[model samples]
Target: MVGSFSDIGATSTDFCNFRRDLLAYISGADAQMVVEDMYKNKEMEPDFYFDFDLNEDRELCRFFWADTISRKNYVCFGDVMSFDATYSTNRYKLIFVPFTGVDNHKQSITFGAGLIAREDVESYEWLLKNFKTAMGYTPRCVITDQDPALKVAIPNIMPETRHRFCMWHIMEKVGDKVGNALAQNMEFRKALNNAVWDETLSVTTFELKWAKVMQEYNLVQHRWFDQMYKARASWIPAYFQDIFMGGLLKTTSRSESENSYFGKFTNHHNSLVEFIMQYNRAIGEQRYHQKQLDAKGESSFPETKTPLAIERQAAAMYTKNIFYDFQEEIWEGNFTCKITCKTNDDGGYKYTVHETGGNIFENEGVEEIPGCYIVPRWTKSACAQPMYNVVWKACSNTQGGNELRTIANQLWNEFYNCMGLANGCPTEMDIMLSTMQELKGRLQSARQQTRASTTPQSVIESILNATAPAEIQIKPPSVAKNKGSGKRLKSNKEKATEKGKKKVRTCATCDRPGHDSRNCPERKALPDE
Candidate 1:
């Protein structure tokens, strides 16, 4: 069990249990009861909010729920959230998505949860819309993975909110997209990570550092690098400095912790009603622990180690655990931060952190254990990227004729992302224009070479040896039974076990019950005589 109970939702189950138990909930009236009970609870406590969607058959297709306490928590700590469908933890195999955030204690807390029959824009849209209704306001920002559906839905649902991607999800893809060798290179990893996570860097400085990393690694021409670079404003911390995402969730992976928390309670073996019971139990444990911490934070005071009012104020403001986090920062601030760009603005002074050169905290052992969880979200610009990768290895002898087309397509897409050119700095524009000119000149020669070296391998117009679908469209034979109208099919073992015992035959002359007619005792005696 996770130490924090309010961290996640449940959705993990094996296939056998899913077919039996999940079907029972979906096809029967039990699923409706769960929603009806939620409604009755909502009526009892007006703060309780629940919404669901039904299919043509009136079966439950999706469910979203946030109780009174959950809504209250949202009012306190719902500025930024991380939510995802954890692996199935219910017998029904519905996707369990928990809307999780960090509380004042810096412990993971859940604002709401949802169960969806499928992962799609419609389901995500419904969940976000209900979340807004329950909370009675849109959050200032939200953090999520680059889920295609979510990328499309969040804007439509909450246009005012800043949607940012989780750095953890993006970093997890590094090994696959950049190849294991480069991904495993510690120097490259650290440089790239430092560039992306440094919230203190200004946008121009970040762009330059990112460009330097690409050049150092000879990844200036890499497709993935270009795509990520153009879209950096969406996910990178430097771009999201205005949003309070780092302030709220800089050190927490609420979704991961939440999954761990709820996993202890909900499992695939649970019936719909049983799962609800377990969910309640888990929430109760979480709330109770949080309350205990709140009491400790309020009643008990830690011994002040210094005369600094900031340190003393932190102790007063934060919970015991969060205060420890603050204390650690206070000790480390000597190396990381500096008062720079200080000037008098209007009636007061404006102090901005130094934004030029390398990040001051880059290599000071300041990066956390889970570097990815601390960052935030996506650009609408990359929403329609082709799902397929045309991996045209240009150096290979096995070149396709359409190789140049793919390259041209990538170039065109990148060029199309230059919507900010009119407002960009003159130096940046000069650099971009010069680079494009050089690329165009080189690409013409490269295209000629690629076309000349193409092999004449004939591509098939159709699947010559296509196979049929794996499953048979057939039904089992029914067994004939005296009592039942529709008996189940009997197996070979059943037939063998249920066969009537060999009938005893009467002897021909003595009418013996134990002997067969062909082997009668009188017949045997006559034959012997």
Candidate 2:
């Protein structure tokens, strides 16, 4: 019976009975022998400790610890830690994780353990203290979502760390301030992202880009971006190289991984101790596997490199077709043609060319291709290259050894026709003069119309001055009317005759509208005046 009670299937009651029976059985045994047996069994059992504790020296355990510690230190010392707090199933508890450094190539390293706390300060303090304690030093940088508690606690604890607000969080706030479409636009979003990263750009550049984005999105002044930019110096890291704490930082993904690990053990166990034991066992196995992998190679695999030759080949293919077509145009007289210039008043000429019996065919009223243009939108001063396509196309044909002398003469004539002599018709100064005259005429007409009509400002001011002193309108006191009684006015004689009618009065104490003050309890209780 005692043996059965001590078996693996033993209940709490059975355990108690087994202990009692064990005492009875051992009471007469050799005490020294029993003590030796117990000691031996205890030694045989594996040593168990918390995975996060400093004493966890297993190779896999060391790798996890080193990786996590490295990432946390990097984020703290270099990047911003964007933190947010959420509740667990347990009441009066909070969990905080820093969201940042997520990328496609590799997972972020700054992710650390989830912490529990009763209040904001406690939670933030716990996170900072644990980080410092684990890394054996303070971090130099921090980034987080704007939580008041974290904002307060960070300066108090890690004062040296550069604190930054998360751009994602800022964007969310902007969406709330503006509309969803503005926040989601690819071009606008790209511009906003670039604005945040552009170190060489002035603060005005940032403002201009922000305003453009807002205007494009049709957003009103929500002050979200303005407020964020006000604290920009504090939120963004000073250097891109320093942002990752030398590649040690990760975002809040570690806490998520921990949660998932915890879930596996928690769902199958009812007892807290049992759950903990199972969790540790699973962790031990994982650590063992990780250690084996680490010893053989690095924690992560190396990425493959692409060849430069392939890229060159691709670029060559894109530009190949243009060369053959240019040679054919040069063989025909159409390559070199004279362009005649029509002078405008603004000292500029509109250039046009008419071919005289050339093999080159001209299509009338042809719509311009999307990307191809005769003249580019803007010209660069440093560029020796011609802005007009006409020069390049003619030159390409000439280089192919098929240019007629007559066609070149015609081209030269067209160039001179557009550019008028110093005092003559096709000068740039004439074009400017005409444009100015047109503008002046328009302005004079606008002024005449403005003088004829009353301005809105004057009208508003006149109305303001003419208005009477406003008075609050109060409705006359209402009397409940009897449905059967027709609208009637009591004459002065009738009012005097009805004066003997019992008057209903409201009690001051109870606020009942029928009783007199004399019957009021509160009124009666007061001293008689």
Candidate 3:
């Protein structure tokens, strides 16, 4: 027989009893009812807006929240957002949807939150619409996992917004989707990585590398590759690297982390009231941390790398965290990089930036591949002189070939322009042009000096490899629009091939040939054993 609560606390069965009590409380309570009460309470508070949906049976289907602070943060830092519906919280199995943004301290801040009963398009649409309604503005860019429903809903709701698929999520799936043979192939992996991650490569360069990789691996017919290629613009950074994303998030990783952070306070076993209370506590702590960062940002000044006006300006303008990042760029731009004219005549100069730090590729414990592969020098062509506004082509590929292509473009104005060309010097326009001409002259002199010694046998080989075309010109495809037809009708052979190809599901847990890990029978015994 169990005694009073005080006596139970001293016993060995305390934890078990506590868990049992929590379970009992959760089972007895109505989650929807508790949430409704919370809604009513928050309604009384200033600037706290929440909405919910119910099914025909009056069951809670969805819930959304945006408090006073959340709305304020959204207005300031709402330009970029990372929305994810991956986490399932509460015993009710509600899909936790969070619209997260970056704050001043570079911390993940929740702009709004939603809970949905289903992962369908309708549920997502409702959630997104509610978020839009509450915030009164659409985010410029939205990053999320590659969910079909979300892919549909985002554009429907916020048509102007750039919807980016999380590169991290796409890259994470690569190892599992590609077989061991391809995964083990070092050259293939490198090519694939370059194809996916190298934003520095122009579209032409990417196409070249991609074709080479796919042909070598015979992966042109692969379903995953086909789907990913078709959806390249959604996930690939090379497609839209120019857009500003508030540096908040490039992936849904922050949202995932926020989910885990919220998990520390509440559990699935928690009662509705308990869950709400814990959620408030978690949110309170998060906001408090933000406030602390705000105070720190406002009160302090960061030390500059050099006594440049731009560096000082950045230090004064941006918050501490962002200023540090700017400072890093300042230092890197000034010391580690150099500009040389690749080609220059009358029709503007083509300058290539030479950087000491190139792309570094390594396989950690994979002995089959080399320990390290370092691309010591990578170059980007800058079209036109600095005075006339420089347009830099994609730099050489990144060291760690991940899918996010970072294109560093500096516009002609303020410190940004200064750092790129003059190393933070406020020079007159004529002087800058003269400096460019002198640099071009120097490059021509250097190239002439190094041409004979540097022109390897490979250049001669490449020249020999180019076969002169015979007097034959293939007829181009018909450009005239066929009446009553916008679609290209596929032949029977293509249809048959499509029908023959069946998509396979691999078990993540057991690594089995068939079946998903979620439905794997081996999961139960496999974990313990």
Best by TM-score: 3
Residue lDDT tens for model 2, 181-285: 665667766876676656555656666766786576554354666576567665433333344432223233333444555455544212212222343454556
**Which residue runs of candidate 1 sit more than 4 Å off their true CA positions?**
1-27, 246-252, 332-529
Residue pairs with backbone atoms closer than 3 Å in model 1 (clashes): 7-258, 8-258, 11-87, 11-88, 11-89, 12-88, 12-89, 164-377, 165-376, 165-377
Tens digit of lDDT per residue, candidate 3, span 133-239? 88888888898888888889999998989899888888766766776576677887777887888767666777777778878888889899888888887877677
What is the full ranking by TM-score, best candidate first?
A: 3, 1, 2
Candidate 1 lDDT, 290-316, residue by residue in tens: 889767766789776666676776565
Q: What are the RMSD figures for all models against the true structure?
A: 32.2, 39.0, 29.3
TM-score of predicted model 2? 0.36
Ten-residue segment with the worst summed lDDT in candidate 3? Answer: 375-384
**Global fold similarity of model 1 (TM-score):** 0.58
Report, for every candidate in turn, its global Cα lDDT versus the true structure: 0.66, 0.42, 0.66
The best-first sequence of candidates by lDDT reads 1, 3, 2
How displaced is residue 364 in candidate 2, in Å? 55
TM-scores of the candidates are 0.58, 0.36, 0.59
Candidate 3: residue pairs that collide: 197-402, 197-403, 359-399, 360-399
